[model samples]
Target chain A: MGKTYALTGNPNSGKTTIFNELTGATQYVGNWSGVTVEKKEGTIKNSDIQVVDLPGIYSMSSNSLDEVIALNYITKDKPDGIINVVSASNLQRNLYLTLQLLEMKVPVTLILNMMDEVKRRKINIDHLKLAQILSLRIIPTGADDRKELKNIKDTLTLDEVSNFNRFSYFSEDVQKAINELAQKLRETEHRLENDIHWLALKILEHDREIIERIKIINLGAVELGYKLRDEIQKQTKMELPEILAKQRYDYLREISEQVIEDLDKSLVTETVTDKIDKVLTHRILAIPLFLTIMLMVYYVTITGLGDKTIAFMEWLVGDVITKTVIAGLNTVGASEMVVSLVVDGIIGGVGAVVVFVPQIMILFFFIAILEDSGYMARIAFVMDKIFKKFGLSGKSVIPMLVGSGCSVPGIMATRTLENERDRKLTIILTPFISCGAKLPVYLLFAAAFFPSNSHIIVFSLYLLGILVAILSGVILSKLRYRGEDSDFILELPPYRIPRLKNVAIRMWDKAKDFLSKAGTVIFAASVILWFAQSFDFSFSRVVEPSDSMLASFGKLIAPVFSPLGFGDWITSVAFITGFAAKEIVISTLSVLHGVSEGALVTSLQNIYSPLSAYSFMAFILLASPCFAAISVMKRELNSWRETGFAVLYQTSVAYLISMLIYQVGSLII
Target chain B: MTIVDLKPGQSGQILELNLSTKIKNKLLELGLTPGASVMFVRTAPLGDPINIKVRGFNLGIRREIAQGITLK
Candidate 1:
């Protein structure tokens, strides 16, 4: 088998940057089969060995999903060696994770990244001295600098051996206990000496997985661990794990003192970050700043540049593609039925969804910038206080923000939250946030019927989502388990100039995901919709049907929405199609109404009045997210029950809100 | 005194924890053991969940929990 190596580190450690540089064009990025967690694997440019870039995590303790994924891969997959990437500037805390990995006895080569950052901060690290003390080869590298790849590649050739011995910073009594356990492991008949010792230490640390594994190997190991724990507690008067952790930190501090030199005490970047945070995280300024930024983003994407791009694409599809296809069908002497199905159903339906790609890309562009520049983290920090009042953490803000991009990623991002209750609540409420996919539907209706006040209408729809999400969270917290008290702990990565390459890559990745879905799920749905609309159950001849199946279904459900003002069968069917993907709603409308050549604005006005249009926007904003989002929620929450609850809750909220809007508006108008 | 009483930039060593049993357990899980040195990072304008640097990471603790953590 070819040798495998893994890149593991804490968040914001430039681990991904290093991987991208090493693998270059060889990398493949996709989801981890059924899970929403991203899986990245690639081979070294000039080597046969494959490298897997695990998710960024603080430690291998499995407190969070990233940790679980990282730890599971390292321990179970048993890579030939592991590259323990550490940020040289943040050596003290980074070393904590390194020490944990060392205890696992994996053949680890330390890659000290961000050497340039350390130099800029006036910190000097004696790499040779550090390597000697840790008993591992260390390579100091600046991930952004291509020159450091050669040094990293050279160190990768080192023998897969761990020479380090475990050191405990605990009291002498606890150390004696560990030493005894270590001696027992050495004396065992097991051929794997390193694995045995590592397993024993993990047992001492109360690692559930290790304990379970030991039970399967030898029940006697459990008795030995119990005795060790009892003896250590009796002698040290402290918890076994805490004692070990303290001891490790003590040793780390000593090593840090010797090998690290700090020439400057002031962290200039931190000062700047804090100054920015003061305004960004300020209670009064925060919401307004957030609103203003979002407004600018929406204006640029939905009404400004993005709208223009989308309009052009729509024109190309509706005017050019549809006309060409129709002309071809006519020249071939094709039946009118086949021509309408080909031109109106397939082309029009798919065209509606594809036209919204520009808006989605522009929205993701701003989101990527916000996330990469570390402003998204601050948004969480500032919003945490408000979310806390509703029994949620600051981290919950990420899901909500992501929901604005697409509920699928928003629901997936909930994995970062540690609290199960918080995760569930966040997932369920995420659909309330107006996703980018829903923008076309909103813009379509808003621009047509509520032209002059379209901006305000769109803004209100987004605001309504926030209100509903918060209200649902509050209600759920009060009703559900009251035991989980939410708390927030987040690392504030020092703000740097957003790298254009990284931003572009992120934007491209997100846009690619949208396009891939459009090509597959939306494309298939469009074709199927075309087939359904073309054929009908008639007498004997099987001639062209008067009304398609979709039209019939729309008529069936249209009455239920009559209270909401736009009870038109075509409009109802459009809403139903949105369940597949929000952009498909517009496509369905265009196909159903036979408006083969018109802007979404013009097409929407033919179907909805001003009051009904506003109500439709409200409904789409709060409706159950696309099928992909529901599936993601199922995966992240790991419970069909929770996913079902999310869909049910969203649909109910959408119904109630839309009803209220339609009723109130009709009475006033 | 509890962390809630500490001004911004004030540093202190944790002396005692007076939180409810459940909250205490949660705090312990997050590596906030007694005797850890902490520095006040900042407070929100409304003064809830005061930010503090502890155990080499930033943590935001609510006023209720902050009231429980006595600092020396």
Candidate 2:
């Protein structure tokens, strides 16, 4: 059987980066915490070993949910070995976790990652001496450096030769208390033999999770632990956990003083961040600079260069595939129904949504660049004050920005928020941001109605989504999910050139997901929609879609939306199937209307006025997200009632806003 | 004085952490203990969340949390 190893480290310590390097995995590596909330497993390349990358954690103390996850998995799974990845640039703080892992007596190999950063600071770490001091294997590696892979593999696969030993950090009095507590724990109803010393220390430190985990109900042991903590407090003049943490740091500092040479203090004076922040985060220039950058991105993708590329793809799928498939079917003596289903229902329907692949890929590519380059965190930093006025934090911007690429990951990104109220509030508002799935709908309508000003029109729609989100956040904060605003304790990682391979990997993953969905869910939805539109309730063939079962269902809901204009059954069909996935709205229209790409835009013009079409698009933008997102909301919020509330709140807001826009727009135009 | 009172480019030693237990523990884990020297870097635009260099890394903390950190 392959040995299993747990990869653990502090957030932003390059743990996941090393994991990707070792396993050839393309896991998303953000320069922020909570990027990996759960354990991700992959096999090391060319080795019979499996590595599980745990979420970045500060320590085993379980202060946060991610910490609790990593702590629990490491202790319970009892992996064959643990690879503790540490950032060499931040050794003192990172090694606090290393000491705690050593106390657990697990076989560990320490990877001193980002050694190049340390070297750049002119710090010379005596790795041999440091390893000897700790009595464990240590590998000093840099970003993209796999030279130490052999050493890591050997250390992990080595048979136990009795080199492991547990270390102690507390003073003599605290040690006595731990021993007595361990003795008392052995006599209690619940006792953990192997971890008695660690448990005793945890109890002294008042770790609530650990106290509850082993079910130690000994009142005397607790009293002893408290007495010892009081004595330590008198001696150290600090809280128990802080006192212990300081001891670990003191130990690390001593080791560093001996082994590290000539660490340049001048590195602090040469910060590039100061110069960059002066312009990027300037008070008067920040927001406009952000807007200009975003507009430039949208212009290139939506109206400028992206449109031409998409037009070519459209010709390939809409004209080339449709005509060739129909001709082949005709020559093969297939029935007219088979020909229509194959040509119009299957190819044209899925192909309509597939034509926007270039634009979606471009959008995702830019987002991944922002994420990997560490600018997304700064965006949150600059936007926090404005968001605070809306009862949110600047941290909420990360989810909204990510949600633009897609809402599912956008909603999932809320895990990083420290408070439940902020997380739930962010989740509720994230769908309002037009995700990439909604971009196709915007592109379709914007190109047809406001061809000359498509860029401004689309940008306005995106701004409208943010406006609606802020308004809804204000209302919701006042009514429900109100609480003290959490602190914006975020780290601003230094900006680096985004790694090209990582960017390409992220783009490829997103494109593959979009295509697979087109082949499966969108394809199936199209076939079912075609059957409903082409046959009557009696299953008899019908020439007119209005004579079929779909129109009967559409008519029932069409009247409900007449107040916003475009109250036709065909439009109703698109809106109904859109709940499955937002892009399906365009697909359903193409299949049901039997119009190819550009012609569908003209066909839509005959159905509604430009003002009404804009209103319809607004409604689609603001309505509840696709079913996948709603269920993800249900899972994340973990309450059916709250999920239902989100859906109702979003749909109601969409209806009222669309009605207001359409009614006011009609009066002006 | 608290950390919030420090101007950019000024350095101060943490004298006490007057935060809640949970927040204090996190701060300690981040190497912001009493006696560790912390330097005020710069404020973000609008001057709410300020950056500080502690233990060889930059960390941004909000004004409210900074007010809770007594410094000398």
TM-score to true structure, per model: 0.91, 0.92
Tens-place lDDT digits, model 1, residues A107-225: 88888887877777666789999999888988778735657566665677674576776655556666566667766666553743247666777777776656766676566766788
lDDT of 2 by residue, A380-461 (tens): 8888888888888788998898898899878977877776788899999999999989988988888888989877778889
lDDT for A647 (candidate 1): 86
Task: Give the clashing pairs for model 1.
Answer: A169-A247
Off by over 4 Å in 2: A25-39, A159-167, A187-194, A216-237, A263-269, A283-285
Candidate 1 per-residue C-alpha lDDT over B23-44 given as tens digits, one digit per residue, 9 for 90 to 100: 5544554445666667778876
lDDT values, one for every candidate: 0.74, 0.81
Name the best candidate (by lDDT): 2
What local lDDT does model 1 show for residue A119? 73
True contacts kept of each: 0.22, 0.70
